[model samples]
Target: MQLRFTTDNADAAVLDVEVKELVIAGWVGRDRAAVLHHIRELEALGVPAPGAVPLFYRVATNQLSQQIRLEVVGEETSGEAEPFVFFHRGEYWVSLISDHTDRHLETFSVALSKQACIKPVAGHAWRLSEVKAHWDRLELRAWIKTNGDWITYQQGALSALLTPMDLLNRYFTDRQVEEGFAMSCGTLSAIGGIRPSSEFGMALHDPLLNRTLEHTYITGSLPVIA
Candidate 1:
């Protein structure tokens, strides 16, 4: 048996993300306004709006199209820090797991320092090129049967390689994503200190990957590293 995979666009892979939690620092008298202002801006941009608490955003991505989308999903307030929680895109279906552990969800929170950290339950980061390569190796083909006419896309394949964080109009479920809004306060809370705890963020979703973290967060995905 031979399987065929497509490699039409290795440079246009997007990663989908669900917002479990977002941790941010600098909680003061003025932060309330800043948070509200930020929420308003996000809502204006089409992100799902949150209530009067911390903020959260949902994300999704497409590899071939190279687009990502983010929407606000959940919110909560820690005594010290605010945690914005969100749901995953593929949250409804059972996730494809490597270890058969049945881990279906991944969570991320922005620390008070302003760095985003992903929880361990999150899946691995997928690369467009890598997925394309896997598909191509499979040699899979799709056939369309028409009356006296036939059309086929030579180098196109959809892969289940990338894991999804947030899905839309699908199912509903919830999970704990953050340790706390503010693990630590004071000068120790710098934006630099806020980092994604999951490998998906640190290694795959690096800040310099495309100069569009905000875009990725909203859209749920980005292109492969070309």
Candidate 2:
């Protein structure tokens, strides 16, 4: 994927990132109570509970995209705003992304549901070191369009989710995160409830730096012929 990198002191530079590995880190809430709450919430929607907390699901690298529009098989998909970390040229960068999933398929297999939609990533990113000092304060938020209006979908501080280092350590116990690797951290619960929408917006805000990375996309549902 091609992304633009910008730092506080440097100009933006566009680089091609060869992401050889892609992993979706799910059920990564730092608070066990909150994690259980999310599980129950999914259960209410017919989605089964995860076999383990902080489960790692490997996805195809080709599923990553930087597009403003997406097309899914049906209207049963929704987006989750997440903070993603990627390694390129020996440096790790943080950015915002939406882990859009097919809700219908989620009930049968969470992993397959995730692979059912394109993962939309922000076109720009910040060096992880730039936000590491105040990582907990960084905020993740998302919005969905419903009934002809955009409404708050999900909102919370990054503190609610496990830190990137913690996730990397758990996934790569004996090795460092290889170059050309990317992972989308877990997301916050929806403001009202999880539901499908035609449009979604996501953002990662650095309060200390007074800057934000954002992306919005429209989902076009194709007919699910029986």
Candidate 3:
């Protein structure tokens, strides 16, 4: 997929990124309890502990999508949309992505669940430099449309997750994603327990800049034949 981003700086030029690969980075929360809560959920589903908080999963580049299809019934799904970051032209660009997963498969194979569905991504992004200074001023939030109303599913400051520079230094020290790769920086715990929804919305808000990058998509499920 192609991502187009513009900075809050009116003089900055628009950035066009050709997405080549996706690495769903997980367990990247500042609050260890938040990270543990996710691990515990996976454990309940039978996924073994990895002895770590931050981990990475290679997702097929084709699985990336602007819309998501839920192709199974027994699948318990949830959207872990967070502030997505990628590198380009000697800088990092920020966007939004949902690490949509099959909660059922999460028990048996976190790897398989990671590959099961198309990840949802926003079409627009922002320059990381624009927000890096007041990084804590950035906020991330997600909502699920239910019963004709938008309900808050997840919400928190970007500070809750690792900083973009740190994540890059630790995992992509060699600039693995330098040519253009995107990763979801973990997520906030769901307001309610994780559950599937037919529609989802997400946004990255910079109160300091008084700007927002937002998008919403409808989820369609295909059949799961047993």
Candidate 4:
């Protein structure tokens, strides 16, 4: 899907984003508490500040429905060791905190000058959408990594990566997904004309995809926000 950002002036920007494919440890076999404890334990061992915790956002074709926190506190070097958690926690997802400041020198900007949200659609399987209505009938699915790879389940979703301008442009431009709503998992779009939240952007954050990108990397790729 695409990365969108909303500005204070009620505008939006579309930024280039990416998601990384990783299988988290202990995803297939862990309860909710265990998962949380795992993060705590990692914190005890020191994995990183924000690195251990990933904020998740629910994405759709056009709107962001809700959000959750995916705490990543386990070991980053662990493999398949039952007790050893995976690198990709199924319960954990991440999104960038938006500031809307200028930091890039190359990229386009769109104005999402309206109030909107992000959502995904469901037909034969699951697909990301830009319309809020599409999410009305769809159920959330999660593919936590209790052990092996990401196990898709009917629980929740994970977010791809995004940047500050990315969040603004989406809200400013009012872009939408074009194709591949069936075979593919999700797509990206931009919207506009609405101000972002004080700290974050929307009311919720989470998603369903296999890619992620750092905010700095994404910002650099853009044409520089002003």
Candidate 5:
């Protein structure tokens, strides 16, 4: 699927560029305890804690998804509401993505668990510059469909996570986001313990800009045939 971006020339058509690389920025938070809370939450599932602040793992461009399917039964998964940023044409564009993850595998391998699920993301995006100034005003949210009802799974201010600039500086050179590099910058905590859901909805709302980037997808679990 092609990732779309807004151009500097409002009159010009939007750019639809294929991503070259996919970067997953983990443990991205302003506070160490907050980061650890995420790590410990996973640790409760037996995933070892990382001894560091900004952890990153690379995923193939093909793992990027608009919808996702998983074949592993007993594989609990959850949608982590996060800001998706991709660099193109020497600029950064923003979108929202549900960092669909394998909770069962997390205890065995965090990276493998991350790579195990297709990353569901929105096709539309806004220019990073357009929302940088009032960045804190942006809110991130996710809802899980439980028992035929949509229940809020995650919700919080973007301010709770690390600023995009802070993340870029820690993971990239010169604090300049390179073209074709995409990162699903961290997520907010869950309302209840993480669990699987048939449907996951995510959004990035810029109240200051009075706009939002949203995406929703159905997660179909394929039979785990051994």
Candidate 6:
């Protein structure tokens, strides 16, 4: 799929990028206790525990979108705010993306559930090299609309999860991420527990640079027939 991105440089040129591989990295919390807590949280909803930590799930590249609206099969779905990394022109660029998923399908297969919904990504990105020194200081926040009001959904620092390089190294041992490959790093725990929402908003903030990458999307549920 071809994606348009704006770099953080002074010129801020909009470049067209072609991506072929898409991956979703899960169970990537830096704290073992927190990771287990998340596992239990999902288990309570009938989702099975992952077989391993930082499991990588390959998804279809066509599921990626930059649209502000998404339509899914049912209401049992939610979004996760995460930092997305992609290799382009010999460099890795960082952006914000939501791992929107179907909760109902997740109970049976997490991978399939992820494939059930479209992934929303921001149009702007920052070169990893520009923020590598202060990567841990980056903050991720998400909000969900409930009862006509937007409320905090998730929020945390990048420090809470493994670094991008660490994730790439674990998934692709002995070599760097291949060109045109993109992955969404793990996410933080939901502020008020995971739940479905019609409107979702997410942002990645760089305190040092005083800049943020954000995207919001509205979801419409398609009727389910027996």
Models sorted by TM-score, best on top: 6, 2, 5, 3, 1, 4
**TM-score between candidate 3 and the true structure:** 0.88
Candidate topping TM-score: 6
Best by lDDT: 6
Off by over 4 Å in 2: 1-12
Model 5: per-residue Cα lDDT over 68-119, one tens digit each: 4433344487678899988877888888887888887878887888888888
Q: Worst 10-residue stretch by lDDT in candidate 6?
A: 7-16
lDDT of 2 by residue, 117-143 (tens): 999888778888889889999989999
Off by over 4 Å in 1: 1-30, 55-226
Which digits, one per residue and each the tens of the lDDT, describe model 3 over residues 71-109?
434437777778888777776788888888888787777
Candidate 6 Cα deviation (angstroms), residue 20: 0.5
Tens-digit lDDT string for candidate 6 (1-226): 8889887687557767798999999999999898988799889889999999989999999999999988998889999999999998888999999999999999999989989899999999999888889999999999999999999999889999999989988999866567899999999989868899999999999999999999999999999999
Q: Rank the candidates by lDDT, best first.
A: 6, 2, 5, 3, 1, 4
Q: What is the per-residue lDDT of model 1 for residues 103-220, given as tens digits with 9 covering 90 to 100?
A: 1111122221122222121122233323323321221121222243422312111121111222111112354433211111111121222222111111112222331111111112
Native-referenced Cα lDDT, model 5: 0.79
Q: How many clashing pairs does model 3 include?
A: 2
lDDT of 3 at 4: 64
- TM-score-better candidate, 1 vs 5: 5
Cα error, residue 118 of model 4, in Å, equals: 20
TM-score of each model, paired residue for residue: 0.19, 0.94, 0.88, 0.18, 0.90, 0.96
- Please tell me which model should have the higher TM-score, number 2 or number 5: 2
For candidate 5, the per-residue lDDT at 49 reads 86
lDDT of 2 at 211: 94
Q: Which stretches of candidate 4 lie over 4 Å from their true place?
A: 1-130, 156-226
Error of 1 at 175 (Å): 18
